[model samples]
Target: MEVISGGFHAVFPMEDGSRVGEARRHAAQLALDCGLDETEAGRLALVVTELGNNLARHAVRGRLLLSPRPALGEVDVIALDEGPGIANLERSLVDGFSTAGTPGTGLGAVRRLARQFDIHSSVPGGTVVLARVGAGPGPQEGHAICVGAVAIAAPGERVCGDGWAFALQGDVAALLVADGLGHGPDAAEAAAAAIEAFMEDPLASPRVLLAHIHQRLRSTRGAAVMLLQADVASGTVRSAGAGNVMARLVSGTSDRALLSQHGTAGIAVRTPEEQCIAWPEHALLVVSTDGIETRWPPTVLAPLLGRDPTLAAAVLVRDHCRGRDDATVAVLRRKD
Candidate 1:
């Protein structure tokens, strides 16, 4: 099983034609950094070029989210935009079907080059596309559960104050999302400490892990942290949190919000009481920090329920983020 420490390292806003070239260059370099060969990096470059150009030409507001899935030896490219949705999805994939007076091989080529691809779009809402490229095996291989998450720094800030991680131990999985007390370096220190502490013993119960993280953050600025542990054999989920980390369990078309305690980790905290809930079949568990809006409509996530967990994560942040703080959102689900 893979253990992740942070979220997406880069977010390239697709503002204009110039930004497209910049994103393409940076993404190719990211692919190379993941140990991808020249040919693989070149393939990734083309994928980014098509996605970025589409954003510049069609969307009102758009961005390309790039993250390295080191465990899978792949890079994730997710394009998010608020544009007029694809009117005829199936037809648009043909080589000559361009609504913008150019060749329409963008989406088709992305599907062929990427090792994994998934997309969700609506008539009036927007579009979210996921493409994974590199030499790694498919994401679902050798893993019983899949996770997708993203973390980005606040605007004008150099570092993100929020961080997230997950680990697998036998039949159990432990996941965490921590938001340092505020923004900037001090906040990042607290969040990093939280992740380090959690990594020490990931399979511990939620309450125990929360206390451990709290103790470890004592010398830092502190953070609002949430921890969750899911046991596949028992079909149970246990959770505990301090302060404002938000979480939800979605099954079928309904969702339930899990509660957290009223104190910050490290500074002044109570050992948060653990909450246990049944892990319904095919349900999804989502955890996030305060950078995401609390009142985001759960229904907006319906189309993504059966898609890649990372697509769900990216879509949530794309549609609901407050954009003023370091933001993060993670999704977890069992393999079908």
Candidate 2:
């Protein structure tokens, strides 16, 4: 079975009811792009519409993230909001439970239509709902770990300069997050080049893979890159990086910040070093570009570490992103 990879590719701001139809149309188009039949596409549209309406009507500041998982032949819809979280999440999922008056079947219908559904909400903090809709066979066997990410270009940019990729071999899984020097076509070229080289031989140690990516990125502009290789059988993670890429490992009540050398790939790579860290049974690993603020504390993610990897990544981006450069966050966790 193919391992799942990639991030939320499109974002639609759901500030009001006016954008619901537009988001629904975009979701339908993405469903068709994933090769779903008209029935499946319609299902996806309804999910988007319902989620969008919730964001517009009740939530404070909200948006919808759409991830086209072509490998799974599905699309992931993530609804994110700033405040006014559900007072009673359990009751809200019922067919007739609504804080704002309308025959409240939105959340219940979304759960019924989606192939998979998960949600996390905080009273004053916010809420995140993940729903996947598709027509293809769902997640298959041999998925030892879960990986999800969110990479988006800076405002006004046509394409994102940050990129992420992952590879699985036996009990080991390798993940990469790269941010080109600047935000534009050239930066995107450099970031893409790094990913291409990393996948060429992902089984290599993180240090070795960084060297290879450094060489492959010589022609294009350089980038900040971080790689993590986790061995579930051994319960260890080896990480290597350069430039401003950031990584953190969250386990139990605490989280540890992973280190990276002070040099950029391709342009000025110094002697790379591999750092091996113990991987807790339920540990969660998050890697991101400088586009995300690095000063955030662990408590920000403490309540969300156990949620869907993609949803966690999206929350990080929504709250901590710097908004000045391309941002990307890749999440990894051992499957329960």
lDDT of each: 0.84, 0.85
Candidate 1: where is the Cα deviation over 4 Å? 169-171
Q: Which residue pairs clash in candidate 1?
A: none
Q: Per-prediction count of colliding residue pairs? A: 0, 0
Residue range 16-121, candidate 1, lDDT tens digits: 8899888888887787678888888988998999899988888768899887766567888989997778878888666778988988889999988998888888
**Residue 318 local lDDT, model 2:** 81
What tens digits encode model 2's per-residue C-alpha lDDT throughout 139-207? Answer: 634767777788778888878889888886657889988899998899999988988898778778999
lDDT of 2 at 10: 73
Q: Give the runs in model 2 whose Cα sits over 4 Å from its true position.
A: 1-3
Q: Which pairs of residues collide in model 2?
A: none
